[model samples]
Target: MEFYLKENGVRTQLEYGELDISGNEDYGYRPFQLMIASIAGCSASVFRKILTKKKIEIEDLHITAEAERDAEHANKITKISLHFIVKGENLDKGKLEKSLELAKKNCTMVQSVKGSIEVVETLELINLSN
Candidate 1:
């Protein structure tokens, strides 16, 4: 991917559209935000695949990511916490926990930053059948 330098940030043309990346949020997406998104997106996708393979029916899946950045060290991301809110009918917590473990093991983004960044995953299940 090639990026062109813009007045405030850099812009890259992707298949979907143009991507703008900058340190300033006013201009474009911040690097850290993209990183967190990548991690969370990867994890959620993998988890959903696992659930589907297990024949688990779900109504909705949502993920929230929180990151811890160190100000003294170039504001690098030190840790990331991912919270998954799963809404479904008669969902099994045990199966969801196991699926999450598989997701963390298989997710490319999570594995890529394994040694460097601490990743924490948590889950909340809402059963519509209740």
Candidate 2:
């Protein structure tokens, strides 16, 4: 939530703990990296919660996230894609879709960037018992 200037071109991000996120990539994580991570992490967990509450049993869940940045000034992220791979017995595509919709709607990070960023979701439902 806060940042400290360590030295020229060097800084640290502060929140629950201190992390080096300097302007120089050699030092630590970049701001954009953290942003996408926050988005992916928040939505991933939110989806888990929603599915659990809906009594959907799953063996595993994996997510891959990516972002696209604008070419103009600011070069901010314009779109984000979240791909979910769910492994389970008798996974309901309809229920899974509904859960993802709810997660996208409710995730705090997603909601925060709702107006500025376009978020996309995809899923691969794998039935191990098949």
Please report the candidate that would top lDDT against the real structure: 1
- Candidate 1: tens digits of C-alpha lDDT, residues 41-127: 999999999999999999999998999999999999999999999999999999999999999999999999999999999999999
Clash number for each model:
0, 0
Off by over 4 Å in 2: 8-16
lDDT of 2 at 108: 99
lDDT: worst 10-residue window of model 2:
8-17
- Quote the lDDT for 24 in model 1: 98
lDDT of 1: 0.97
Taken over the whole model, the C-alpha lDDT of each candidate is 0.97, 0.89
Cα-lDDT of candidate 2: 0.89
Lowest summed lDDT over 10 consecutive residues: which window, candidate 1?
A: 56-65
